[model samples]
Target: MAHTITGRKRLLARVRRIQGQASALEKALTDGTECAALLQQIAAIRGATNGLMAEVLDGHLREHVGAEGLSAGERERELDQIAAVLRSYLK
Candidate 1:
C-alpha cells in the first residue's frame, strides 16, 4: 500500500486496463454476445488483475526485504507478512 510514485503510476495503468475490460464485458452482455466468449473475456481480465498483483507483490518484497536495510526483526516481520499474503492468494 506504500508504493512509490512510479509504482502507483504502474498500478493506475493496470487499473485503467481492467476498467476497460469490464466495460467491454458489459457491452458484450448488453449486445447478447456468446456466453462462452464473455467467459473468456472474464478469464482474461482475471489474468490481467492477477498479473498486476504479482508485480506489486514482487516490488513490495524487493523494497522491504532487499533495499530497505531493515533490522533483523523488521525483516522477519516483513517476511512473515509476505508469506501470509502469498498463502491467502494461493488459497
Candidate 2:
C-alpha cells in the first residue's frame, strides 16, 4: 500500500499488468516458446517493473520527503539520497 491515498488505482493497475506479464512469461517458458519471443516478453516485463519502481519512488518522495516546510537544500539532499539508493538497488 505504498499509495494509500491518491493514485492508488493507477498503481494497482500497473501492478496487475505486471502480474499478467509475469504469468505470460511463465506460460511461454512452459510452452517452450521461441527464443526471440521469450526475450521480448522478458524485455516487456523488465520495462513494466521499472515503471512500477519509478511510480513507487515518486510516491515515496511526495509523501515522506516532500514535506510542506522543508528548505530547498534539504529537499535536494533528500532527493539525491533517494537517487543514490535507487542506483545501488538497480545495480
How high is the CA lDDT of each candidate model? 0.88, 0.87
Question: Per-residue lDDT for 1-91 in model 1, tens only?
Answer: 4665668888899989999999999999999999899999999899998989889988887778775669999989989998998899889
User: In candidate 2, what are the lDDT values of residues 1-91, reduced to their tens digit?
Assistant: 3464578888889999999999999999999999999999999989998898888887788876786898899888888989898889789
Best by lDDT: 1
| For every candidate, C-alpha RMSD to the true structure in Å | 2.0, 2.9
RMSD of 1: 2.0
Where is model 2 poorest over a 10-residue stretch in terms of lDDT? 1-10
TM-score of 1: 0.81
Candidate 2 stretches with Cα past 4 Å from truth are 1-4, 71-85
Candidate 2 structure, TM-score to reference: 0.75
